[model samples]
Target: MMPETFLSWWQFNNARGKQPDMSNKCPPVLHVPAAGEQAQRLAALSQTFISAFTQQPQFFTRAPGRVNLIGEHVDYCGYAVFPMAVEQDILVAVAINTSGRLNICNVDANFPPYSCDINNYEINKERPVWHNYILSGVRGIQDEGGMQQPFIGINMAVTGNVPPSSGLSSSSALVCASALGMAHSHGLSLSQETLAEICARCERHVGTQGGGMDQAIAFLATKDTAKLIEFNPLQATSVTLPPGATFVVANCLAPMNKAANSYFNCRVMECRLATQVMAKKAGLPWRTFQKLGDLQRALDKTLLQMITLVEDSFEVRPYSKRQVCELLNTTPDELNQVSLSENTRHIQEFKLHDRALHVFSEAHRVWEFKKVCVEGGAYALHTLGRLMQESHKSTQLLYECSHPKLDTLVELSKGLALGARLTGAGWGGCMVALVEEDKVEQYKEHLWKSYYSKEAAAEGRPRNTLLFSSPPGPGACVFVK
Candidate 1:
């Protein structure tokens, strides 16, 4: 039976003045395209179900997918980053629930029902041992606020197009969506700082330790521009782009599951170790050296100084993204005594390795990256792109993070007269390519004919080289229908 058609609030969220109960300020907005939306309409139209389920329409909120233009792997250390929102975002429409629980539904047929009892959720150092990023946001809201701030149940339906683990900050989008949805539902006010903290901590519930880069921009980004996220001091700015210049990001459906190798955590530990070695050499506390850029300065001084202080301490193993794929030959669940954190110590590398050199310099590149974008300098962007390719060489050569197939895509991207870099933690994931808008068509064709479709013909793989533009999508905001 064709489902009844109630007003599609989410579909119309972007319509001017369509958002309900919003004040004069440019409130954060969301748009959710979901199958659960149909379910809601069906339930509303069906007399018996509407009466039985209880009907209370409420506000919808959303957060967008994020691509870190620069400053990868820096957020966890509290470094500033540059990120923008895209047109794609997760939309959440929430209503108050007397039952006092977070009820969630999605349009995606594959998405299962997700629910949590608000009364029972916890946000302590070790709690909510689940993948519910929103639960952590809820915990943050409660913990960060006073008891005088009461809580309310949320009846919600969420849906978005961003793929999970695609290095697009999809999870952060969900966290931001839920945060603002709940905030609006209960008439609460929040700032970017508060929202970012909530989202970052919530991510930890799922066993990932990350800084707040994704959450911050998803929560705070404005429209059609870039934002620079600063780390040494936590500040953000919306930057205007040079005329006729756009950032083109291509997503390869070749989503390598980063979780398998704890790729994110391993890198974090490596950074910690690198800092410790640098600290001893500097005769200062590890915490004193603020940015990764600082460590590079110390390392450049002399090899004797580094060798004495960072001998075994500078550990770089083959635990990179490519190595993870090779290691996948073993079944993760079947293995006993498998500790990523423990074996992490195994993959440590020498501090003086070229990859470390790339990493050490990459920290500085992020800042230079911002300068090019902000200065509207063509030479600067291209110059930065050269550094990016250099960075890729480091990841592929020094860090050993590239797969033959992955490297092919980078080569393919470069062949199309574009500048490219291996994005995310590397391995078999997609790379970020900056192509002129005019050249996008040629780039797409080259990628497919060269690699994606070739994989299809040989192994019957689905389309792999997916391409899109990166928009400065906003964080969690509410929309009413």
Candidate 2:
């Protein structure tokens, strides 16, 4: 096999410049289903190959995009969320050498080089913070004995076609790629469990604390299908996209300010408080309430009571709708004479309009959406669109994770991209879009004028915005793609 570096051999064969007859944009020699591309006519132009490229056959890995079908903000809140790996992702071509060196070059010109070595892989080093995601993965693997003793130096190059920070889990895609490369080169077979755990730790390298959704999706998903992944004890099940219509996604171009100290943490704290309040009322620890009916009843009662007291009950907060015991530490029995009508109003307001409702409903919506997607029923696209809108509404009105800029972008996208909503962690993160095929160009044009143009004028040429369509690709793969 001549060391089986897939690309090296493919390029060697392709060097004769033999033209591929078919119109498929993919190369004649490569049949990687994970690539999620299949236009037999090679898509990469001759310009792409002018510069020499190397693929170390010793290691190969792929990671996919994580799309939160529903339950966007509930992941970090200990709430069940539904997300799936889309067809798009990052593929890493890695090779090990005795050169005692680590170097990385991205296929796209957008990001810079990622180079580091065993000795210098310190905790939270600053110079190449951008590559920290991958570095962290490598370090985690090494920490867990996934690395070999001889310091298996690597010359790795990455090709990232995935849009950055559009909330598609690009960072996770890269982390998994690095982990696979490291594990393969070091002769380690990391079970999915270990891989997910390693990925969680590696993600912190990006300087953003994230749940394991991105990494898990990249590692576990299958082609042409979405996976409903659960974090606790780690479970994965497929959720199929409807056949006829493609769910389109657009980049709102607005970025999240997750780096801020209090923003992400405060939401986390709030969710914790909600769970604790529910647990206390139920006379159980915060962990139980596995059934939907049980969870719904508790949340509904808790919130409806708070909503009832909103108007006349000065003790109840219009926003949080907490009882005196919740806020002022008063006992529930002490308020036995409290106006039931007023208290009920407050609880209703909280249940319907408060963030608690969003968490519970969004959590529940995941199951609903999964069932609809799996059964292949005639679920209208409008209905799907409405669910997406509701998901965003919950994120915004209830959860308060959405940003003003994102809301504006969503408003702007309404006339163009069919459905537009926040994609990632909300609070100033990326938004998703569902554009019809022919309307894609029109949508992008409108988006450019509306977002990038103004941004460029204000800030001297903003980054490039990508628009792509990919079918569900293989979860993660080696030379088989």
Candidate 3:
């Protein structure tokens, strides 16, 4: 069924000349639910928009946050990642205006209100505020559409349930929802694949060098399945999760804002450096290689072989700047210019051996995870759980991304959960656990008593939000009036 979004686009394009039909490729459009909790929330959101702008909204867009069941920190390495969308999401109430200015307000008063000329706004990388994420989406669409005329300005009222900075991808969902609203406003009908790619690239404007996993899953997810999202062309394949498996996510109450610090980009740079060093050793042009996955393809080696290569090529000790420079046959300045990001350019040492090992092994774990899910059996859950445990260990020991609090949560889930691991960039965030359907309540209560109840930060927050089971939910979509 063609949603109002596509129908409106078809009507708009008919006047301007025909455009490619992308109905199947675009996000599904559905009527706003007439009753139930979603309807109530959207109804309240519509009223919030009217109260803020004194006019009815044109439409609404939603983009869900995701949980990476496995495959952590491997997307930027150009490897496939397994992630499923969650029920929590960011929703925007949007209306077009001829004022040529963007007006943005948040339902939560903490954000306050923001405005800028539609054609004149810059995303603040140094101190990115909430609206900067929305602006990033607008800017991305503007760049992609390249309209000669200024885009009709938009008024947006934003509300989200996804916990911010707790690594459930709250930031990416905002960018995607905003992007979807902007595209629909302009009568542009881009495919979901195109939108996901654009949002992924544009979110970097906020200065976090993330792999595309979050954004890819934001758009490509379906209602009841997890997706194996591959990069270098961005394809998603549905993988049925083993039956009777329930995934529970628990926030450690520690928030790591990726763009606000250097940890995330530091890891990215380390991976790049490792890939280059490996390439240089293999007689391949090191400068041309950035992702370990690319290097693996060039060498025509399996993931296991790459792990072996990592062991043989480097020591467990961190590589000093001088050591890396000498190995690459380049000076420190050249190394910084070629391989490092602005945030990671300063005095540094890199743990190349462990980082490369984590990435290669984690990539292999993703494949193993897919295999176990595809070939489900009595032992499938046990095997998948073991793979998850191994992935977490690699993230903790080798990647060095897991937080103490995150590790504590994982540790707390030891006997109750099949396996648990930190789910996002993980300098401090949330952990996802594979729990059986029958054990979900028991698992959550165990964590609450052992972890959340004692934490001062989780005080006064709803227990369900802090600890809940998240099945694979639907991808991003639009709800039109």
Candidate 4:
């Protein structure tokens, strides 16, 4: 079914004028060609599955990667995020197997085939090999179904073009796709929201300690409309883009895998520590607060007031671990148990002021961006653009996640794009720019010549996929042939 079908189904099942209710339902089943542009790709993947397993696939699952339009790093803070699903996604073809072994292969030859007993497999956090993402999903479903329950084995062939480690949620997409396949193969019926939440928790098995933005957008996004995804009961509301405004994603050609290092989690811990300190200051149970959003709510303060509180509370200097322990009135061991992840326990210092500043401010920008979209006018594009630029500045300066290449891309877009910001978990990945529809081609041309054309990484890379305009695409779904 097309996205119109999703909308129509929503209309059919509910009273008029209410928002589309997509909860408590399985992903809509569609025919192969209903997948549109990727029909041929799905067909080829299905053929590969047949040859590998000697049986036709019972079904296929697709989960799209998302580009965060404005909100960044706030999802884990329990704030809302605005993101749209891209056409690029992870596609899995699955068939039941009788051998009681889970066989996994990739359409891309770089990944070697692997098999394991479905009931006995471990996700590797040490190396985070490509298949481990899929394994994260398998483990998620197995746990969800209860380990004591028997599960039939499955053969899965995977393929994706979301640019791994490019901050586009490719890893999360794989996890969602695998979990969806596993759930369906086992006669389990799960909603998109349930699967998304499960995949989000399970992905931590790979050691990223990420928030749920990636997985939530992957499952809940709708076609042609960006979604404002709120956590703690994950809900999605569609936001329409203003007319004549185009969003383009360009690769910085630098990739950072969140699981391969501690940079990502370090920021997560910084936010956590900031929240606890503030909670304690506010006379709330510090241990109960793990997110800045939750802390803000407990205080019943607006985002602006939270920003002010951060300024009043934390010194600008980086807080050494010892200093942090002293402020919290706890020993390093107790502090570690309360605030730090395993990967971040070794960290020496935390920039509580800057990280808190960024999260609170960026969380505010998400709402502003949505407001500009909701109240579209002659100045809506420019207003939204300005908010995006501000977001980039905070991410670069305060969060310290932006890479030199990403900064350079934003610098290059100063005039050509209305606004541009590093889109993903930033150490290196892609930057999203907002451009007038008429200026999009010129913007791409300028970026290619000034940026990609001069880099060795771009020497043989395809320009179309590397730099492209993206509208919101549909969420995860299953295809029945």
Leading candidate by TM-score: 3
Query: Lowest summed-lDDT stretch of 10 residues in model 4?
Result: 13-22
- What tens-digit string does per-residue lDDT give for candidate 1 at 1-481? 1111222332243244323344423355434334575345433323322232365445566678876666556566444566777766676556656566776666554765566777576544333322366666666556653335457566666666566656777776777777666555554555666666666666665556667787777766877777887644446788865554456665555565544455656666555545544555456555455334456455565324433444444445433433332333333332212323443545533323333444545556666767776776557556656766776676777555566666776787775544676666566655677666677677767776776665643355333325566656555565544
* Every model's TM-score: 0.74, 0.69, 0.95, 0.94
What does candidate 2's lDDT look like per residue over 232-330, in tens digits? 667777777766555555555555444323455445444444544555455654444333224445556543453342222232244343442464344
Runs in model 4 with CA error above 4 Å? Answer: 1-24, 34-36, 145-148
Better of 1 and 4 by TM-score: 4
Each prediction's whole-model lDDT (CA)? 0.57, 0.58, 0.90, 0.89
Give the Å shift of residue 93 in candidate 4.
Answer: 0.5
Number of backbone-clashing residue pairs for each candidate, in the order shown? 27, 33, 0, 0
Residue-level lDDT of model 4, residues 326-402, one tens digit each, is: 87788999988888998889999999999999999999999999999999999999999899999999999999999
Q: Candidate 3 — what's its lDDT? A: 0.90
Candidate ranking under TM-score, highest first, comes to: 3, 4, 1, 2
Candidate 3 lDDT, 412-454, residue by residue in tens: 9889899999999998989999998898888888898888888
Among all candidates shown, the one with the greatest lDDT = 3
What residue pairs clash in candidate 3, if any at all?
none
As a whole number from 0 to 100, the lDDT of residue 324 in candidate 4 is: 83
Better of 1 and 3 by TM-score: 3
